[model samples]
Target: MTPRLALADMAATVSSEDLSNLQLLLKAPSKDAVRDVCLQSHRAPSRRLAEATAATLGVPVSQAAELVRSLHVLSHHVLFYNLSSPEQILALFPESFHSSLKNLITKILLENSPTWRTEAVSDQISLPQLKDLDWRVDMVTGSDSVSRMSVPTCLVQLQMEDPCPTAGGESVSTVTVELSRESLDTILDGLGRIRDQLSVVAGK
Candidate 1:
């Protein structure tokens, strides 16, 4: 059997070291598939193997996150492991990854190296955000009754105090939201849609 099939068949039963080795040997595209098989086949997936596999691959940040999420090994160290370039790391990873290390010793790392992407350790070393946040107001829409605004990210909730009240005398309009984990592709697609919408609005 090819490395892929062998991994799929034995990924669940394989030891953590062997599983991680198998993942590194297989092609990048096949890694997620093997991960799925292992998840379904095992009651509890191996965090050690999952973290190892994630550190080896160089796909988008969203795909790397899914592996950690599936294995329930969400951590600052595991997600950012073996990556390069602080600029690239900050761009690729989600905001949650940033928030995770915000309170830790990342401030010290920033002071020392200024850019340390690969040496992300939870207890001893923390990755800091040295770059400035560039937040652009993508869209703004409002009505006499209620207001609405959207950014480049998905249709997430943005809370603010409204001055006006609804017909029901409710000052706040509660929007029912069902949240799910978004992939890198999903975010990029959302941004593309926002860009097209902006173009149409501007008569371009």
Candidate 2:
């Protein structure tokens, strides 16, 4: 049978027993390492194998999807977050790719934050603003091709207190910054240029 057909059949016939087998296969080591066992069983397509394997292991598809996406986010963090220079980060992609990359990063950051659900306080902060200044990213990866390419997004919230006094004589203020990949790049670039210019002046 064709690999795709074989995969379809495996998906259709998946059972507790199949799941058990897959679990055992996964236990051996990494997902790639278990490929031989999966291939020998029926030579299913990788996508089919992932679904079937996930089913067997009792992992819900949604949870599996999230896990897969997380890995992508992690990759971006590793690749760009620690760069020693703005030029270095910019060099990773062509100028044309920058806009899309920034957009993706922004969307990922926004999607991950729980504050997105909160109503904006006009005089205080909006969801995007909160996201801007304080958020954390988490990543996950899985065995499927889709999961490999998927970006899992989530946010860690930061707490801020208002120091301005309100009518009740209590401090009242809110702040947030919704950060996207593009916004982050813009912010970074501004800071870098300022530093560089400062250095040039100081040397004169």
Estimated TM-score for each candidate: 0.17, 0.21
* Every candidate's lDDT: 0.37, 0.39
Question: Cα-based RMSD of the predictions, in order?
Answer: 22.9, 26.3
- In terms of lDDT, the poorest run of 10 residues in model 2 is 1-10
Superposed model 2: Cα runs more than 4 Å off: 1-134, 138-163, 169-176, 197-204
Q: Write the per-residue lDDT of candidate 2 for residues 78-137, one digit (tens) a residue.
A: 222333334443343334443534344333333332221121112232232221235665
Tell me, by TM-score, which candidate is best. Answer: 2
Model 1 per-residue lDDT tens digits across residues 1-204 = 111221222223213433233232233445345444333323234455455455556544444445444333212222334223345334433453434332221222233222322222222322232222222223435435343333233334433334444456744444423232354467668989999999999994
How many clashes does each candidate structure show, in the order listed?
Answer: 0, 21
Model 1 poorest ten-residue lDDT run: 1-10
